[model samples]
Target: MNYHLFKRAAKLFTSLLGTTLLLSGCQSSPESIVEKITPLNPASDVVPVRVVRIDSSYQLQRAGKPYVIKGAAGVQHFEKIKEKGGNSVRLYAPAYADVLMDKAHQNGLTVMFGLWMKPPYEKFDYYDPKAVAEQQQEVYRQVQRYKNHPALLMWNLGNELDNHYGDFKVYQIVNETVKMIHKLDPNHPVTTTITDGVYAIPSIIHLCPDIDVLTVNVFNKLAQQPVRLAEAGWKGPYIIGEFGGRGWWEAPLTSWEAPLDQSSSDKAEFMQAGFKMTVQDQSSRCLGAYVLYWGNRFEQTDMWLSMFAPTGEKTPMVDMIQTLWTGQKPANQAPQVGAIRVANKLAQADLALEPNTDYPASVPATDPDGDPLRVEWKITRDVDEFHTLPQNRTAPETIPGAIREAKGLNAVIRTPTERGGYRLHVNVYDGQGSVSNNSFPFFVGVLDTPRLGIHMPQYRRY
Candidate 1:
């Protein structure tokens, strides 16, 4: 009996089990760890940006004017954002603060200026007085630089600092930073975002006295945001810093452990639900909500939660946000691609196809205003930053005439010669800049060999 072999087998089994649990949401790694106020102290004699109770509800006011933050997360499409009834944009960094402010002001929109902070996992130590003092000084400089800009709405101090730090000193630093900002620039309020709605919450509530608003960035549980806040007894005003479609962590998975995604319409429905739960519920503490990844991002999948496609094609979710913001639907609604059928059959999870096989794909689509619909099909590999390993993404693989669009509803797509996962995406456009897309993922080869029990050939009962 070899005890070393048995020990190695046990260690490998435990490691694999932990990884499985992490991926299954039953466990998480260590170190993964809100509101309000008045015109108290009158730090700068005049504070224009404030949260006011308006008819039993709360609204963020800027320059003594009622302001509901119809904000998007990204800053690329200011014109489209304005046209879609968005009045603000949230930035995560100050690199292009000047340019963004100019563009947002031109578009009749305000900006939620995000102040990037060093996470606890980073090089800086919040406990170190010198480091903290330097950060405070830098924050003051940045605030003074942009505080007078008309497009500046409020100061978002740090984004999800709790994710990596469970230390109470981080919030203390945030509190100090807020105090400095109030003294330097009292016109704008200060806020810090959280990934978890309720985390080290007591410390945040008690320690961070100067925080004006408690912003939360949520995903799958976004619809239950209000409930969670209430459960945590968080009475401070809050904004949905970011809420998108289903989060990749909890999304349904295929046999290959890849996350199954929601269709565009389904995503729009989730966004609507999120808005209803957080922003439109008429709660006094609810100010407004911002959709995450307003523009296209390569997170998990290209179509994960972004309102617009990577090619600048607007999805139905855009119209959903516009309607929610304006209380009226867009004049020209986008086409809806309800479902996609591959090879005249509906593949429940993912369609498995033979290499170099020809498969026909079609979508059921309709335009809202009875406009003519044009369906376009494209094929690409399922490799993405979130899902694929870094080593596996060495180079772009050739799809090899993967999809050939037909004249009408159907298109014939050829499977890739390589044995891997691929996707067939369909875009239904109304010829009026409104578009809806659906993607069907397919595997080009057989599943990997199933794992048997852990083998320790040299081990035996002692």
Candidate 2:
């Protein structure tokens, strides 16, 4: 579990530099911004969902009511998001939009509906008239199918189209599709997402005027957004398309090259700082923010980014989101690993492991709410890459036959044949949907050389 947020503290420096390069100009005064972005629409049975730009500020309104998108990017957990005071969910595709819309509307939440667009790095050619026409037809059909859903807020056109892409024609296609979306669904504004704020360039800003908002999915570089937007010189509104814990791309790597990670609690703490600095800054032009990957999936580690575990249990990151969105923590607290010992030693420097060795470890943990705790252990080889592009997304290689599971609170872990860097990870679940994870990194060295006396051999040489 994440005992603290001290691991990879050096990475925070890089986050600052990234932030400075992205966002620069001071934000407009709240009074001036508020007055500039006030929606012209009066109260009515249904206020059109739209982005209003008064001067330096923009506001999203629905039925003439002010709405800030406390949204998460996930299909599951609509009820949880709403209960946690989030007003929306951002979907990556329309595959389950029909069902999601029905559920989100029932839960008194809106949806930032996403339309999947193929990135140009793939075989799909945006320059081809036939391909573009066929894609536009598909887009039209989907828009026609779901434009009337009450839960629909805005049209998120694509997710990080700039990633691994070289052709600027992609943006041209986006301009075309957004223009089409506006024609078919005027009630909702249209937007597109980039991997980070740095992609919000002047060309994208000027090229797609039909696009209302420049949404960004920022991980550790979140603090750079304001500066990035200012650097882009775009005057339109923006939204945090995806954010939460640090991304696998930017985290520190182990000696063997695996991404060093934060505990669940530490992820929550970094998230708190990120939200406070960017999305929660009311005076800034940020329209709203969406937490990334609401459900669990393997990304570096199972617990690396997902707010929920595979069993639908929430991690401390989830609680942090609840507190940020609702101004209060959840009723249940996650289990905390007070100490993790390898070979009865808590220090990494002291726990020197040898190849083909078996080692004993203990994860002493406690639950704040006194709930029964379940623990799991995992070990993986560290890798050499600190960051990855979209095309290069992958988890570190697992050290096979490495962990021998013990009954409780401990395990007998097997070391790899080759010496390098590896980590012992522990996850503690409180069964109340709260969990904490901790990872202990250790070094593996070669077996010691055998020594023998050579007194007889020296006499023979003479």
Candidate 3:
């Protein structure tokens, strides 16, 4: 933070906060760190934000007004989100926290800033008081520095910590951190995202009640949240921190055992259904939802859940979300390329091919903008987890060589001479900065089960 920005934030603190008091510094006593960085909640002119109960329902009241979060979870494309009628953005970590806060404020978008917490999965031992206090010291600094920032909506304490986790002691840190935040900044509420509904909600209810609102990153299972929450005995306000298409772990698997990636249109349709079921269906405890991956990145494929592609082209999911938010679509839309088919069969079919043999593959697609589309085909090596290397996991296209012979919508793929598992990828590009992508996973030889070519962040082994 620079001098001018600090001055501007200080001005907002003067107008909104009751008392703009500064802590001495980011110092935490090893013996009692949470005690050292204590909280001070004075009477304020306005309640910056809080989760309020209304009869049998709940909603977010910000500045004395009911606010629903129509949000996206990424750092880029803030201007576009504002145009599409999104009022909030969720940051995953602190790398761009202050910068995104400033940008979000400029765009009139509030932020659900995510405080990156290390769980036992990352070998962060909650049992060790020294380590726990060191982390609290850092958290204290972050809250005190930006607590009065105008764009700060809420603090997401952690993300999905209960997935593949076994430590109950972590909640103590969470509770202590939330306690510190409540004292330092009373304007915004603190939330910790974990595996949703039946799986982790109960533990939070039992172990961590200091969390003001329950935030979840659910997928296709979003519709089941009501039952799951009820079963877990959580009857409070909640927000869909992240939601999109079905994850590859849940998607249909090929005979080779590789998960088939959903088409661009398929993802948009799934997101549309999810948004309707949860946000639009309008559960009493349900606040609005946030569509995910505002920028493009690879999990299953190059463009599995990203709202925008690497070329800065928006996906159809973007259009669907805009429609859901504003009841209107974009002036220009992305190309709707249905599932890529192999041998005139869908990718879901048993896509087993001979080694080094030519196969017929094509993706039927149409551009809504009527921009001439360049359909390019390539061979991607989607290997099992045993063979998944760093390069292949991060950048798939750079491996297994390109199918130079394969061009246009209709193309013949010359398979690799020796392949265990591979994928036929089709990427349709419109000259107008839009792209539609899909992939078909197939085996080289007769194989029943190939390796899983996916990344599970929760169960990462050290």
Best by TM-score: 3
> Mind sharing the TM-score for model 2?
0.78
Taking the tens digit of each residue's C-alpha lDDT, what string does model 1 give over 312-430? 87888898999898889988888877777888866464457798888888888888899898877777777544444423543334365887657556889888888887777777778
Worst 10 residues of 2 by lDDT: 453-462
Clashing pairs in 1: none
Per-model TM-score, in order, reads 0.79, 0.78, 0.84
TM-score, candidate number 3 = 0.84
Model 3: per-residue lDDT, tens digit, 1-462? 999979866754453232112122344332234444332222432239888888999888789899899999988899989988899999877786767888998899988988878866668866555566667777766776667777778999987777557545577568767887788678899998876536566667777889898888888687787667778788888889888887665566655557768888888888887778777776678877788888877766767778887778887888888999999988888898887777688866666678777777787899988889988777777845434532467756544444636657888777777768787777888887678888888777766544443323332211
Model 2 CA deviation exceeding 4 Å by range? 1-47, 337-353, 360-366, 370-372, 380-411, 416-423, 440-462
Clash count (model 3, backbone only): 3
Whole-model lDDT values for every prediction: 0.73, 0.72, 0.75
Off by over 4 Å in 1: 1-47, 53-58, 121-133, 164-168, 344-347, 387-398, 404-407, 449-462
Question: In the order shown, what is each candidate's alpha-carbon RMSD?
Answer: 11.3, 14.6, 10.3
Q: Name the candidate that leads on lDDT.
A: 3
